[model samples]
Target: MTGKRAFVTGVSKGLGAHLASCLAKDGWQVTGVGRRPRESAEVSAAVDYLQADLSSAEVIGGLVAKMDAVPDLVVHNAVTYPDRAAGRPELDTIETTMRVNALAPYELTLDLLAAKPDDQFCSVVVINSESVYHADADSAVYAASKAALRVLTGGLAAACRSTNAAVSTLMLGPLGDANKVEEIRRIAEKRGATPAEITRLFLRRSNPDLVIDDFIDFDACYLSLRYLAELGAVANGMLCRLDGGSAGTLV
Candidate 1:
């Protein structure tokens, strides 16, 4: 992965930020696009930050132009967490969700492929959610969008077969975040235990055959990226589920 170029979306924080940092550490030139401004100096130094909202087609087009040339890797990790308490989602909400989650990535991929030479190798990784399989109270639209993304990835695999570009989708489960850890930590403190203990208990309750314990942090997910990158270097299309053994059999 050394000296490879990667374009990552949603690098403002969380897994996106972590992915950017890990790729940079591996000696890859990373460019991260996010809606928010880059705040951390570490993240800022790890990748070139481009601030743009994915919801607008115009903004996405501008982003495409800025790339100059197609990158070796394109990671669609940016997402909008729906407001579950908003009751039945409005038409606008559903439209925005689809646009940001599925449409933007699809369009950006096409543009990148178009900008590249015929034999250039490119890899696309879409960070999807397990919610597509098990929808929660407020994630109906979100789940649908991810499902569409999965379908899109399949189509892209076929479309890019002769173009030397590989497409992959990673259906992830509950990823750990600072706020989630803090909340769990408070509960663990009340119960006279550590956060790691509570996290293990939670995972055991979630699934007994958990492959990786602890929250799905940057390090855990980074392995998936590496796998995809390696496969993309040779293969055309691949779908992987990384939900800590909760997805059962790979369908």
Candidate 2:
């Protein structure tokens, strides 16, 4: 990233913010897309911000021009996870999840690749998750959406073989960020699971003897993002598991 440009999605907060900062610190001219790109203080320091919602392709058309020169690194990191439904939900959560998690990233990357065909070491990384192989009480939409992304990564990588662009994917496990934990809990609770159920499985279950008072940390999220970014050259068109503990892996 010495003299390259990086574009990351979902940079309003969480892993996206950390990823943007890390890339800028590594000398990448970074641009971040988010719902509220204006007031992201962390993003402002390290990269330019665009208020683009992945949910709407109409908004993305205007934003694409800003990066027409095309970036060296593109991360389709923005995602939509579904809230748990106590009763069967009539709403098409899978449609929304699939569009945001899978289609938008695929479309965005294709546009970027078309403009930057001659660029060297261009990488498109999708942030996936362990949930792909594991089942949750109410995560059908989320799992299916990420599975779509996983398939896209493989197909895109094959397509990129003849070009300079490379495609890689990373799957995430649980992180240590409080906001992420809260968000997960909210989704879980919406599915009718109690807070105690969350604590027993996501928190103390992993540690066995630890305190339930623990919260997710930001550095772990940053480490996962940064690790994938750094591995772009060596890991072109490959899906690497970020979870060492088998969460993101099948075996």
Candidate 3:
């Protein structure tokens, strides 16, 4: 499969771009959808980048309509949050974020397979956050959206049972700066609590007890491609963690 077809959303930066490049290197035909296409020579050379406003359902619908075939692999890795702490309307803000995080992915996954309903040609991977567990005061909307996306994952997993395709959920934890630890430290200092007190929050709460892998190395992207590829059609509806452990994990 020199040019195995693959489609990935939110591929302008972060883990999405990394995943796209890894897939390309692994001999897959990569179609990456990004909102604001950037000037990245790496992305330009290896991947076919499509600039589309995924936040708008109509635009997303159009992209879906134009898809050539059911992608052998679909990686849903886009999200928007409510940093609009800047006097934005609450309903619209939440709606837009949820639409990006949850609704759009659900719709896009279905869109990928709709044209060829009988096509059981591959895996659909969803990128989610470890924050899917508990909610902080400031992160209520974000956590809710991810929780809903997980539910969608479960539903889609069930739907794809008879088919040959599979689903993989990569629950990516804090990585690439701008994440937890710091947020927790802020809360700890504000509450006049010790660092241990904040650290305790991550020490396994009842619900998922989701763990965040401390470091994010580039190798995790390659590992994910091989993991999904090795699973073939055996791993529908499975959630895989990308941990940059000292030894690393391989399929």
Candidate 4:
């Protein structure tokens, strides 16, 4: 093991699960936090699990206080977007969304920073999303929360300039679900076109020269996060976008 500690939130599924597993394989001591236990046995074997609802500051504070080791890397990956089919969200919806998507990271990072030794190194990575740039009717609340997170992360970077703490944000594109590949295959059969042909047309709509999947792949995302984690204090205040395509790997 590298003997480095990594605390990752939202490890129940998707990119969170993949990241936890990847880091564990790379010899980092990983602790995964989620609202519930991980569903995948493989991921469960990769890291210690901590279950806590991120919407509650009290719960997050308690969680942080109970940590036995200072994490070298802290990944704020948990997020929530309320259903907004009925148009503008109610006041409660906004509160809940902000609590989970924005406030949770704020409270968690501050708590971790405060608890760490003055000279100890820590890297804070907030897994922001592209939705923040393209807030449609269905995503206004989520985007607002992410925007708030971006600003707060920048503030944290400044606050840590004289300290050992580092903060960075990874704004990401839509992550491709594995199921989308199969769905595209089915669509290809119906259209009497190869999957590659269909995917090419799909790419053209976004970028004519792009032929790869539109969603950011899990492996690439992991590489980018790993880069920031290893870069440590040098990466402070960095805001990077991983589009899962031509953006390429940071490694």
Candidate 5:
């Protein structure tokens, strides 16, 4: 083992799982936090897993307090969206989304940074979304939350400069399974039109460089994260957008 350590949130699946596993393979001792236990035995074996609901600041604080030492790397990858099936965003939904997507990362980062050893190189990576740039009807609340997170990360970056730490954001486009084709199909049917027509409409509102098929993979996301983590303080205050060539596609 490299004796380097990492703490990653949202490790139950997807990019979180991949990051934890890949980091472990690279000899980092990775502690992964999520709401539920990892279902994959192989992944579970590779990571020291902790279960905690991130929406509660108290719970997040407690989790951090129990750590033996602040990790060298902290990745804020957990995210939640307002239930699009419930129609327009509700007050409660908006609050909950903000708590999970924005507030949790802020709280966790502050807590971790507060405990870091003096002059140690620490890297914080917030997994963000392209939705921060453009949002469809179903994504407005989520986009707002990510926008808040972006600002929070910027603030953290500034605060960390005195401590030899860095904060960066990886704003990503649609992941493999998150392509909104099914959502578009539903909207198309509701509007008495074809799915292709709805897709065209979505395209009009999206970035001109949008590539519908250029969905990102979990491995690629992990690679980008690894790069940032290795850069240490050199990547401070950076917002790296990984849009799979689709810069402003609606999330």
Candidate 6:
């Protein structure tokens, strides 16, 4: 991937930041977009950081203006993780999620593809979630938004078939995070059980064949990016599940 250029969204933190760092280390010129500045100086130095609120349609033009050229790879990883306890989610919440998780990426993909030269091979990677397949009561809206994105990804792949662009969807599972673990612990305490026991029960209920060991970590993002980068035109429309086989029949 040396000398290749990549545009990554949500690089201020989490998996997006990690992916950007990895790509820069591999000699890819990376441009990161996020609403806030990167917290880590080390990560900030690895890529050209651009602050833009992806939830709004107006941010698209500003984002494009910052890019030097159409990138070889585009990773859509930005998202809005709404609190499930917010009670019967408001319409605005749903709209914001849809705009940020689905529409923004779709628009950006189209814009980038349109700007690319005919001979350049561009790869678009959408970071999807397991919620699309395993929906729960609390995450109804979130799941729906991701499902829409999954559909959009399929359509984008088909549209790019006759061009030099390729689209890949990475359906991700649980990633390690202290706050998430704490949240699970709190829920487990309320249910009078250990975190491990609660987690096991939840996994079993979600899918009987799924094991707790199937959850992915930060490294999975890196692996997925590498796979998408190496993928040729023949594998343009691939929807890969990086959930350690836990998706089971859903895939």
Highest TM-score: give the candidate number.
1
Give lDDT for model 5. 0.82
Candidate 1 positional error at 133, Å? 1.1
Tell how far residue 176 is off in model 1, in angstroms: 1.8
State the displacement of the C-alpha of residue 216, model 4, in Å, after optimal TM-score superposition. 1.8
Clashing pairs in 6: none
lDDT by residue for model 1 (10-117), tens: 888888888998898889899999888667433647698888899998998878789757799989998986687878888888998999999999999888988888
Ranking by TM-score: 1, 6, 4, 5, 2, 3
lDDT of 2 by residue, 1-251 (tens): 47788899988777787778788887889989887747644564768888777888786555667774678778888887776654554466667788889888888877777777574667788888767776566777788788888888788888788687778887766555556667768977887997556655665555333333444345655565566667755666776665544452234
Regions of model 2 farther than 4 Å from truth: 40-44, 85-87, 180-234, 248-250
Q: Candidate 4, residues 171-215: lDDT per residue as tens digits?
A: 787566567778878999999999878766765675432335555
Which RMSD values do the candidates have, in order? 2.2, 5.4, 6.2, 3.6, 4.7, 2.8
Worst window of 10 by summed lDDT in candidate 1: 37-46
lDDT of each: 0.83, 0.72, 0.74, 0.81, 0.82, 0.83
TM-score of each: 0.91, 0.79, 0.78, 0.86, 0.84, 0.88
Cα shift from native, residue 26, model 3 (Å): 2.1
How far residue 87's Cα lies from its native spot in candidate 5, in Å, is: 1.6
Cα lDDT tens digits for candidate 5, 1-251: 26799998888776787788899888998999888755642355678988888888788779887787888999999888877788888897789889989999998899888888887788899999878777777788899999999999999999988788999999887675434666877898999998777766676456666766444667788889988887878899987878855653434
**How many clashes (backbone atoms < 3 Å, residues ≥3 apart in a chain or on different chains) does model 1 have?**
0
- Screening candidate 4 with a backbone cut-off below 3 angstroms (N, C-alpha, C), the clashing residue pairs are none
